[model samples]
Target: MAEVEAADFETAIAECGFGLFNVFILISSVPCLTAMVFSAATLSYVMPSAECDLKLSLLDRGMLNAATYAGMIFSAIPWGFIADTMGRRVVLICGGWLDGFFVLCAAFSQDFLQLMVFKFIDGLIICGPFAVVVSYLAEFHGKKHRAYVMLFVGLSVSVGAMILPLMAYCLLPVHIFFNVGQLQFHTWQIFIAITSLPSLLSGFLHMFLPESPKFLMSQGNYNKALISLQRIYALNNRKSRDSYPVKKLTDATPDRSDVINNPNPRRSRQERYKLAKKKFCDGLMQLRPMCSSPFLGLSIQVYCLHFCQIMCVNSVRLWLPQIFATMHTFRIRGMNDTSMCAVMDHNTHGRPIDTKSMEEECDIHQDPDMYIDNIVVAAVGLAGFILIFPFLRIAIVANHILKVFLFLSTFLVGGLYFSKTTLTTLILSSIYLTMMGVCATTIISMSVVIFPTLMRTMVLLLIMTFGRLGSVVGNVLLPIFMQISCIAPFLWLCTLMTIAFTISLFLKVDVQQSLN
Candidate 1:
């Protein structure tokens, strides 16, 4: 009798049937994505109230803001390598727990140096799940639903951003202070702790989820991969595993054996050490394919786009709390006829000193309007993501959408620079930031489609590494640029967005021809 050939991965996955399990996967992803946003962004909200506690100067604030990105930039590749070599599930679970732990540690930090160290470590651990989760989620879905699922992940991110300001509104204004021995606990500290719960919860949720069947197949674990698909089928379709239509998965790499399932209980120390060394070297070797041939050009374009988009978006996004606070100060002083630069200038060099007052210099009271403004901005971004979700299904629409958003963002950035009223500045800035954010997610979705499964996580991490590097640079430079001249940072961002838009134009060919 002739042997039966197994179904291909995509075909097998599609047979798993998208229902309860698919929805569970998407629901489970919310906290993981939300944790990434909160870990990176919570510091922006914390800094305003924490300045007095940490005794932060402008340089200190910039460094603190950049610290998490610095950690992510350094660690992204290693996490990617681990995910590619091992499995995505372990990486996500372990990373989430460790990230949450570091965030909790940050909450207890008593000084600037301690908090800085913890925040950096938080970034290092969080990068694991942040870079891997999207790839992990995409592996489960068929090509038809993959792009939409990734965009939904992006929408979850915007939800996380919206949650941030609401949390800040409820927590940052509260007056809480106490001393536990040498440690001083404040409302900001409590806020940090609260923000960390999502990472922990995400880790907990992953414990119940199955490994990515696509990742299993990539490692030549055909039997285990088929079993995984069956499990997915059982959960998603509410049927017995025997009912799964795909009996087996086609062996993509027949030469490679299943490294994950066949574990030896007892091995000599020397043998174990040698095995570890070989796997590490093999992981390093995985980078070669991405750096050469067809992938190299696509990698470069997406990486540059990620860098520029993140640089512009984060440079403004991370400083929004401070900027809003500045506006509050301006309004307090009855300044009506002022641009953003004028308000900045007034806050910097024109404030009248009230030496007669005997009140504490550190005012942690955030006005209600600041939080409302932030919520409004986040809500606008969220709405944009929802509105654009349906159009993503159209052919070539993602590419066109990217170009339009980038061009609009560039124009909005320039307009933001010239706006003389608070409402005008807020509206332009909101649209600009939202558009850039949407473009960023669109780029990630495109990358997921363009790259092969073998090097997908590696490519994403490399792209994200560039993006975080841009963020670190932007966060550090924006402050210095503002001090030099307000327009310098805006002009710099405008130039970068223009360049990104141009680079995006070259990506059409690769995007149109993607295998996914």
Candidate 2:
């Protein structure tokens, strides 16, 4: 028999046939991504109702809101290193379960301090799946389908956001309370437990999935990589493994120079310690290339764009419920002619004009408009994703689309500042946030195509670290800025979006071409 040719990694992946496995991977990712959104966003709904329960001041609310981002910022580097060194699947499964546990713990929190601690831990763990899943899902697809699959998963973020408000609307209104020993449980606590389910479910779903075949190949484990491909081929094509094509994968060199060369397992304790030390060193060394030469410039550009994009999107997103609540209060007070700034002034006054009269002011049940407005914003974002899905296939469309979205976001932020009525403010804020979110997902898709596999997760996590820092900064500064001048935060967001728009222009156009 003639000698068969060994196929390259991309060729082997393409031959796997995108069918059952691809859909499964995509479906699995929705919960992973949604869990991330839920973890970050749960506080937005919890804060308003839990205010009386938790004794939360405005500054306390801001700190609790920023706690997740603060934890994520600190943990990003460590998670990146672990994901790259171990495997993407390991990070996803372990992180998802731990995050869920912490979120559930948060539901049992007796006070603001306890909830803050739990939320921070939730942030610490959830960063793993949030950064690693992008690489994991993309590795399953060939170039032709990679971008489309990523965008579809990105849409799940909007889906998660939409689901949050609906869940809040349903659960926040119900009067549920119980006594668990010395602890008191309320409806908000149940709301939090329900939100944790997604992370737990995501971890459970990922238990059956295989490690990325590309990561295996990068580690020079060709046999295991081939086995993974065969499994995927078998599942995707509904065929026997024996009938799958591409029996061998080419011995492609690792893109990363520091691919760990595992030592023999029977080594002595002292030798094992040495090996562990060497592996740790190797992991640190892997980051050097990203900070130098060709990668350095690309890294800086993407990091900046990510920082600005996340800063604008998450700042507005995490606080949208509060913004809507303010709008709701304004409407109830018959201040229909007031701008968002005027509403902020009303909300900031430390004392109520008449305690009895203002008793129903911040109550979400009385003002379903807050939840409805948030649902509308999230739905519009979801719709934007659906509308843009068709254009994602076009060559280099991500770049142009990103630029256009950022540009529009700038104007939307400005328009939001000038918006005088509730209707106008909601409309402009929805479009602004939707645009910023789309830009964020577009940048993530671009990163998958632009960076090599070995460093992809590390680079992504680092990018996200800066992005989370931006979120932390925005969350912490927003209240301060609002107190100084309501228009100040809007102007600040506009400036950030404008800078991000300029940075988007510098991103390599070849990213889309690489996908093609």
Candidate 3:
């Protein structure tokens, strides 16, 4: 192994140059991550419509969602290894291509089974970007600013969350366009394909972007890493200084053969510590030896976090629209069966006087304004992640207790049955929002921090896969309990969160400190 000496660095970044490149990279990657989240979250909206239009059974719908997760669960480990072995750029590019292809397939699917298969495959392939992007961004920046930079990643996904409903509303008309005779391609297919263009553009842009300097150093490409860094500085229009202030690698930069054949270096702690400071810049790309070790404790912690977090988030996200619809029945102003019928007719876009009206009538749904107000409860969940960030140094045991209490309280309170009164619905919906928002942000951020760099891809994909499974569970329960007591779905969500709360008590390591 060779060492990357400090004498090799060149402090060439021009004023305002580095900031622009960083922002450019962030802008490109944010949408890539955002699209990933948006597609997953919006699937619930698409599935039922596809099912009803295609006359698929409830079992078929459940299979579609489950199929998506099943593919994800199976593909993650290998894909992570690929990202580790081949490179993030290749995997990310392929991920974008696969995402575009399968989404188009799903939109064009003629039968329920076809849609199921395509979605499953898409889910598996799309995860490559999600897992790789974090590692990609983490390597470029200093450790001091990692958390704050990652916050942008979180906000990007939040933006995705906000826009997903609008996309859903816009594309819902795809079904209507199906009845037309002139168009060769259906509207849904066009919608899916259009959504994928950003990913395609990202893939091309990534080619021009410099490979992670640390990754090159990890592969014993010290000369290449030097060249790449110089190019980065050039692109940023920074002055081409003779050398950089930072050392490129510590713990010895392994040769290409050595890295490929041996990811884990059996080196002494003294040797590792010696390189720690010098290699700080390049260390971001170095995989912790334990990442591949069979007995690694961090791996287990991340797995549990991913599994539990996804289950809770997906369970709530899939149920939100229904929850709001349930609350709508309680509205008081100018409400009557006739008005409800008229509203349903407007929403459904139909003229069938009696039969169609009988099948699906509205609750004289109030202004969609109420939807935003009631859903504020979920904001508490989102807030919890941000609030807990500064205090994350506390022991996991203490954090575990608060997390459990937060979820259990929300579940129990939100699950309680009450008259369909407008006020009661408003209050309960708020609780539902809080529980879900907090659970999602906390787990997602925690997952990124906990997983070892090498296995990040695997852990994230597994988390998302489980989350999709949760959505399937919710969707499946929807039709069964749709006719039963109105409170059944709420009870199911409460139980799922309670189970997650119990699971959190067993974990110990905080991922945020894994690198530290």
The C-alpha lDDT values of all candidates are 0.82, 0.82, 0.54
Give a tens-digit lDDT track for model 1, residues 1-516.
122246887778777768898998888889999999998899898877787667677778889989998999889878888899898999889998999999999999999999999999999989889878999888898877877887898899999999999999988887899999988899999999998988998899999888888787777777777888888989988889888877656754672445556778798999999999988887777678887888898899989998998988898888877777667666765767668788667444553455332123336235555677788888998998898888887767866889988988888888877888778877987888788878888888888878877688888888888999999999888878878887887899899989999998887743333333
* Residues 288-397 of candidate 3: C-alpha lDDT, one tens digit per residue: 54455642564555455445545545544554443444334433334433232232232233322464542232312223443453234334434544564555444563
Which run of 10 residues does model 2 get worst, by summed lDDT?
Answer: 254-263
lDDT string, candidate 2, 294-338, tens digits: 889998999998898888877778877877777776666676656
How big is the positional error of residue 292 in model 3, measured in Å on the Cα after superposition?
A: 8.9
The runs of at least 3 residues in candidate 3 whose Cα sits more than 4 Å from the true structure, single-residue gaps closed, are: 1-4, 7-18, 47-52, 170-191, 231-237, 241-243, 257-298, 322-413, 416-438, 447-451, 466-492, 506-516
| TM-scores of the candidates in the order shown | 0.95, 0.95, 0.71
User: Which regions of candidate 1 fall more than 4 Å away from where they truly are?
Assistant: 1-5, 255-260, 263-266, 347-365, 509-516
